[model samples]
Target: MPTPGFPPHTLDDEGSPIWLDELAAEDPNHTLHVVRGLDPAAALEVLGAKPQWFQACELPDARPDEWTSLPGAALGAEPGSSATLLAGRVGEWTFVYDDFGATDHDSTEALSADGRAAATSMFSINADASLTYAVDGKQLAWINVDDLDLAEDLPGMPAELRAAFTAAGVVEFDYLEPGDPDYAIAMRAACALAGLACTLDDLRRIPLLVTPLG
Candidate 1:
């Protein structure tokens, strides 16, 4: 089984837990740049300094068959290398987006190996402040608090968050208790949405930010 924080046997290794905003704190002259949804110029605007170009930090290279089996097939670039706009992980499952605008290239495919395979779990914040869960780079579930009517459609949801939907008179489904399949995962999603700095295990160990009962 893959570990919770990092996968096993992937070519890339996990790095320290660094947030998106932390890149600016580091001296740009020394560290290589890793960005998401921003190009070098945009990154400079957001992070305040143009860091070095990115280079994939790969381990001893997985087999070709292993590379082809992942969700998004390693990586993807734009057609004719006009501009690179894609999302994937580098070493340590760090999410980064590289945009090479107006450059000519051969094909749209980027790297050969799935860099995201190293991530065992992750939470993404949607545009509307909703939350989604991804395990092993595959989306497991999502909860859109803005739309209460669509609660039943939420499959594999955790019990703690399900109450949020029910309280709003959205749906009345049996809730999963502590020992349920995705109970912990749901808790993490809820805490993340609430802007809590908690992990999968932290949900059980620490008090939630939103106070699900209140």
Candidate 2:
């Protein structure tokens, strides 16, 4: 059995979803652990952090662990000034923002809530790996982890990764966009296939970036 942690193979020899493997290779410092069974507020407290460049905003209805912010005065006229970035908990997962200036400096508009979800690292990494094919919160079909072997014929799958899974006798799962009653089922199945304790319900509540505690 694979150990439940980082360094790729630590999780299992069956191997994690190919995308997850690549993600770990890119940023081994953070491990993606499932978040489950915690109160939303408590989860936020543990997960939320104030974003570095923005001035904080205090909303009347904001939860205790929530941090809402507009571009700070120092950002002055830069794209950050026009944006409102939020970092906090929504439902069961911790919502976080990556550095926008570092990656998306050309944009002229504020980040909308759906944009926030899309901009979040969780969605980005998954999309990059073809784990969940989505953009700006709109999910398209995803590679089925349970049906990887069949996925070799997928139109856009990365060939090297496809060969890797195929060589390993892995079966990739192919799923449609969420909204079908089976979306949750797919998430649950993926988690189990990946040796994760986190549930589909946890994922449905919010898309979150997983960070290693230590």
Candidate 3:
């Protein structure tokens, strides 16, 4: 069995953790971006947040309902705009979580500039999920977690990446049972590959800093 914080073992005989499933059920739509080599503050800045406007908050406090409930003026965002994120550092990587928001390709490329790397894992209410990895300012690979074939022919795909995909069971996503924790497993495995040891507990208890999405 792979270690708890590592791939394969992350989801054991019990399947995906209840918290992860509950989070997806509650939020339905969210995106998580992990940036290597940047602390939480610098990662938020790279994503276009002003230093003075930063808000210290927990991950739960940044949930869509909680955030949207606050007046736009309070968040320094346009009224009714769903453009906020909760970010924090886990080991050497900064994890940014956004509700109903996504970091575009340009932003990921920018975040990964100068020998750094970044990855985004997006989940939607419709059971759709995707992950993208970028390194040194270029998108290295992208894959729809539900469909591995979509990425089988990616040109210039690196061997290490393919290995990561394989180790994560992303390459065999099609074989998972209907109710398996495929999304969580694949996403966590990819994060592990980048040296991030994110767990459901981390997501729930981490001291996340908040800012409006850039």
Highest-scoring model, TM-score: 3
Pairs in steric clash, model 2: 144-172, 144-173, 144-174, 145-173, 146-171, 147-171, 147-172, 147-173, 148-171, 148-172
Q: lDDT ranking from best to worst?
A: 3, 2, 1
Tell me, by lDDT, which candidate is best: 3
Candidate 1 error regions (>4 Å): 1-127, 149-195, 198-214
Q: Per-residue lDDT for 73-161 in model 2, tens only?
A: 11222332232222334443332222221223111111212342121122222432223322233443345333433423444544432
- Residue-level error in angstroms, candidate 2, position 39: 17
Superposed on all Cα atoms, the candidates' RMSDs to the truth, in angstroms, are 18.2, 15.9, 5.5
Q: Deviation in angstroms for 207 in model 3?
A: 4.0
TM-score, cand. 2: 0.22
lDDT comparison, 2 vs 3, better candidate: 3
Write candidate 1's Cα lDDT for 54-126 as tens digits. 3232211221332121111222322222222222222222222222211111111121112221111222222
lDDT of 3 by residue, 169-189 (tens): 422245665433465554654
Least accurate 10 contiguous residues by lDDT in model 3: 65-74
- Alpha carbon deviation, residue 46, candidate 3 (Å): 2.1
Candidate 2 C-alpha error for residue 60, in Å: 36
Candidate 2 residue runs with Cα over 4 Å from true position = 1-9, 14-113, 116-131, 146-154, 157-214
Error of 3 at 107 (Å): 1.9
